[model samples]
Target: MNRFKKFMIFGALSVTLLSGLAACGKSEAEEKKSSKNADGTYEETITIDVFDGLANYMGVQEGWFAKIVKDKFNMELNIIAPNVAGNGETLYQTRTAAGDLGDLIIVDKGQQYNELVQAGLLYDMTKYYPGMKNMARFDEAVQKMNEGTDALYGFPTSVSSIPATSPSEGLEPTFGAYLRWDLYGTQNYPKVDTLEDLLPVIKSMQDENPTNESGKKIYGFSLFSDWDGNMLNAGKQLTTYYGYDESGFVLAKADGSDYQSILDSDSEYIRALKFYFEAKQMGLVDPESTTQNYDTLYAKFQDGQVLFSWWPWLGQAAFNTQTNLNAGKGYMMVPIEDQKIFSYGAEVYGGKQFIGIGSNAEDPERLADFIDWLYSPEGVLANSSQTSGSSGPEGLTWEMKDGEPVLTDFGKKALLDGDANMPSEYGGGTYKDGVSALNINTVLPIDENPENGFSYSYTLWESYQRDNTNPVLEDWSSHMDGAVTTMEYLEKNNQLLVAPGASYVAPEDSAEISTLRNQVKSTIVEYSWKMIFSKDNSEFETLLNEMQKTADGLGYQTVLEFDMENAKAQNEQRVAVSK
Candidate 1:
């Protein structure tokens, strides 16, 4: 059956269910007449099923925000939450398959969206997104969401950026190097500038001063088996000064046009693999890193057994609150030297959590209007504010203070006071306060500040010690820089190899491509991990050559070409938009 037809059938079933439930309490006729209308607008009650994770912070439908939407939009919202075992991805897929998709859907998973787009179940919002033209005033990343496949499909919410300065100066920290300052004081722990510098610290912690009660020497660092860990390790292996050429197909650029794949080439992959092996051999990396998940690693940190680990800054707050580790005494971020700390900007694709009309939306226009309201200035304020009653969800705005909208006490406390160093009981601040100004990142007008003040303002200067004076580059320049750097670095630095990209292919691709990509990725990761953790250092050259042969057979050349073309097209499009 067609998606539209299936959606209509589901809508009918929902209407019938509502009627039946209403009839149990009232006469059938009364149930039928419950909806009121005036001037062609549905006075009739309508319910929109929304699949969301808002419950984590906002609680259930009983919240004040829920009441506001109902009262203002004249509609009821039914939210379906996934079970612990089933994340939003599983629930969304199941609902879509059952033809029971919600009127509005908020997808947090990037891979899932790729699948849904292929399934032809999602509404192509290109026709419905005039509301977003205003959003062009926001970051270019936000604008790009509207241009996927040359058609707009979604709206991206605003997110904050990391400050130009480090929370501590004289420390050259990179992504994932979470230095435990509480244990390693500034004097004892000098700033680490290179991977080589990290080794000595790790060795000192391991042999000189083992802190864990179990008598196991605390490793200077820990690595994870998951994708996040992989990214961190990869980033560390290739410092941010030389980032991946996400736009260029070249591992090394030959002339202005010639490109090569680092994976298919010999030197880069081997060097990256060798570094991992050396770290593992030196006992700097967790022996169980390949098996342990984040929670397990976090537990180690909480026990004060770890002096340093790799994770986002937020980990500090989360760890302090959940663990018994003396928040003040056991941990703080360490300073690294000469390293350009590179945290991922909030602007990446698939990071934008979007709410959109689904296949089952009977009143799409109404749904669109509601969404517009949510993204509108007042709506943004309302949705973000804290509510009133204890039983009710706090309004998005807690209360207006001095003409400014003070976030809920929780929000205010989280934003203003929450610091990595602060104990969790003290309410580590929210990401809101640390985020960049909304006017800088969102399409909203800068002049239109909330009467109270900009609630979304970021303390970039207060937070970090770096030079924030560089003019913001145009989106295209930044994008190209990323691509070119990755490509050129791979080509020139034969020893530095990136993990094969084919491993992350979305599930929607043809089975043949998926199988090939998976095999290539699996081989690289397996061999790379083995090399890093091997007890007997086997010849690295032979293994790397074998991996390259496998990648070549898997169509590495084709993949590189495709990447180049895609990058060029995307860059051109971005440039055109700017003009």
Candidate 2:
């Protein structure tokens, strides 16, 4: 059947299935059962409306993990997933507005979770915490923050702990400033330790050789103006390097209290803009960068017309499919500045697409039981691995070996061994070729020590096997120690700023807040662009002042006040907890 018909059929079946479950009233025994399971371990059946992104991988329809759930926990499973077109976010908004929310809804975005909580659409999981002791193992700060006003709306999935290192100990973290190994030979490539080091390399590439086989000039780098690529790669990340902190109500501050909005006349801000403009003028950046989307940029990178660009490692894998550019030839995650990387911490719980129980659930206890079961060791394995027999249209599936959910042999071999010669899982259907040539060239050396003990464990368990341990682990204890020291220093000095409350605003305010934020951000973008393209830096001050004025007119101060209030409230709670 066509995809549309299939989706309709799936949707109807899911609705019917859920309705049937809802009709089955929760028995007293089930409530007692759920309560017991909540405390320790128990099992119950629950239906979940998940997005295709997750369902396609887990093989939910084929019931690959159902037998495990039934045998282990005595639970039945009902899954509702979109088969085509829309993503988790879109489907969630639609269902929420229609009041057709399922017993469990998996929300992916922080903003969305905040809005749902604010709207009272989600159950306060905090109330049930007495039954959920497993949650206690999570970070304390994260648990407290997610329980906004005593109502815990979601569970956090990814949270990185503070590293121990001085800010000045290593190179500054940077974005999109990597040397393209496929285009530039490793021998001639300069050891780029920082943004400053990249200047000479760009000049050499532009001045020395311009065109390749097709007569298209080879640019030193590709600059993207698209929001997803540009904001993530340069705007947000590179801006952070220049001391633009995102924590709590402040944007860019010269002193702790003196907020010199980045959209305004800040010297550091001006310098950053000037750098980009110079790169553009020197023809080091793609001229079409501002206009090109990711696909276009990917195509350019794949064709080897662009030598360097800022993008995720995943993107590199996706586009460079050709044998020459594939595997070891095309990509290398060259760290910018050789500095200790500090990734921005996303929201704790509500940040993930969650599976929330709806008020309409006939057996809330049963539903909660099912969700709890999903969190069990077996459930986590089933969801994460591709051992399940069914492979969805997305060409994604989970595999199980010896009852443990492991990546398909194809996936395991590719990532672990870096076997370029072995075709990817997408190429062959269930082909098991042992002794595939392992490509060891792509694996980077990792620091191994007590500080990185957890990371080391994860790498060993998931990525590397005991039999093949060529990449010897390095001593990263000092680095970890330094990172911890740095964090302690910042916290002691009250310099570990929190992200602005505006960052976690609900989606309900998106239209208005986004418009306001865009206006302010665009001013920064314009001034930065102008500074780069301008022959003189004289206009920088005037441009920044005008941008600030525009921002102030667009409720910048109001937003700042709101964020400050939220931060104050948060701090008060922290103080209370201390007592």
Candidate 3:
């Protein structure tokens, strides 16, 4: 259920320590006791303020996943949503300002983490759940880092429950361009080494399949305005080709902590914008790219009307849609020239959601224990095995076949083919958590899951066959007579890097530059889109000049100065640590 949304690499995270508030935690004798009625059933309700796509509870109230939670904790989830999104940013800010944030809360890392901690709105789990010390998926160090200077408050969620130190052996370009698989195959899978080089392939394919059998128009490349949240838009993915997280004011090469405004004719963003410009001139730009939201764009892709995806996950589901069944295909993660997947692992979190209990909760201890349990192997198993629907559904939600944890056929169907709206059908809270954020947003580690079982690996499920006893890594080996998958391409090229995304520059250093930073980023993106779409090269050049002038006039250089200082410090730390 955890997945990338725009920029979020969804997965649950691990544990930390908070000794000062330790008494609120259970005594040794209390650990054996469950907070249940004498009948051993949870009869209460706990409210949660959720964010983004997980707000759907239309039929999730009957989901079995929800039932498991009630059966274990004697309580049920009461889901809440903000009037607006950005992971409940407005709601959280408003609630924190008022000094209450429901019984439970889930927010993205960074800004929200700082806000809640600075406001003293979250409970310190160490005081209430000393038991976190032994959690199977616990991460004392990450928890400590997130805790900052205060007692640990937020529980890191939506991150790997267990850590894998080894580099990934696949070419899953979390960031980069993706093309509809069948189209690329038809073109003989030509190498696309740069953004400009990709233009012709898309145009050629669009020419061949200009319209679907239904006659809907297909575009060569499309963009989404929604992904431009907080300044950077989809173009940030282009920065990934250079192995850096796009901070707008700062840029680095190969994940080197050398920050500063590196935007130039040769910079990643400039190159990406120029590529878009060329695509536009060549009649390959989607008019919708400037007007549509991701939902609209995805709908087009779902119908196979989309020819190229700037972000890999944006078009993932579309490839598997029933409409694309005969035409059903996936996107090949084609690399741009010289681009390599940054070597990623524990240091770089794909993305994470942190969880926490409200400070005003009647009993923080129970909530803390519930979280600790979620991170434990047992908790992760229960939380993760929500028989499939959406994403990959080829494994058991949870089951034992001949002493091996295995996925059942029915379970796989429930995930892939089952109804998204199950609450109306199942009734009685059986599907209450089905298709909701709660289904994901908890801790679990896929790498640690065993073979011949229901692991969280999508590659395994998508390629899983009844004849294969060992499931997880076999997809690549089984394909095309031992031919590597897209992931294997990057692994073979060693493009992966340890760029855990520029946490090198601490938050405070950039706090003063927030306004200027936003101004510069907004201006760049504004012009980037315009320049790309401009009818004349002269007009495009004019906009580019204006964009730079506006940034310089707004003291963008001062912003870069601070970034440079912190980046040097961060790189120093990186060097020292490596040595």
Tens-place lDDT per residue, model 2, 89-126, is 35645565554455555444355455555445566554
- List, residue by residue over 1-579, the lDDT tens digit for candidate 3: 222332331221111212222223322323434444666344666543333223433222335555556556645566654422444444444555556655667655565565556555666565555556434344653555454454666665544433333432222445556777677667776777666788888888888888865798888877877556323465556666656654435665445744436456566667767777887887777887888866677778767788887554556545543323333355556566677554333333324456777666654655666677666555555454222212222233435556545445544444433223333323333322353345453533344443344445433443433432222224324432453555556656665555432223244434447666656767777777788788888998788788778878977788777766666655554554344
Better of 2 and 3 by lDDT: 3
Candidate 1 residue 310 Cα shift, in angstroms, is 3.7
Q: Which 10 residues in a row give candidate 3 its minimum summed lDDT? A: 9-18
For candidate 3, the lDDT comes to 0.54
Best candidate per lDDT, number?
Answer: 3
* lDDT comparison, 1 vs 2, better candidate: 1
lDDT by residue (tens digit), candidate 1, 150-247: 54445554322222111111111223345554444433655566655766665665666666766665776666654321112442333332333322
Span of ten consecutive residues with least summed lDDT in model 2: 1-10
Query: What ranges in model 1 sit over 4 Å off?
Result: 1-102, 107-120, 124-153, 159-176, 206-209, 212-218, 228-241, 245-272, 298-305, 320-338, 341-354, 362-370, 373-515, 539-542, 567-579
lDDT of each: 0.41, 0.40, 0.54
- Per-candidate TM vs. native? 0.58, 0.56, 0.78
Error of 2 at 572 (Å): 11
Question: Roughly what TM-score does model 3 have, to 2 decimal places?
Answer: 0.78
| C-alpha-based local distance difference test score of model 1 | 0.41
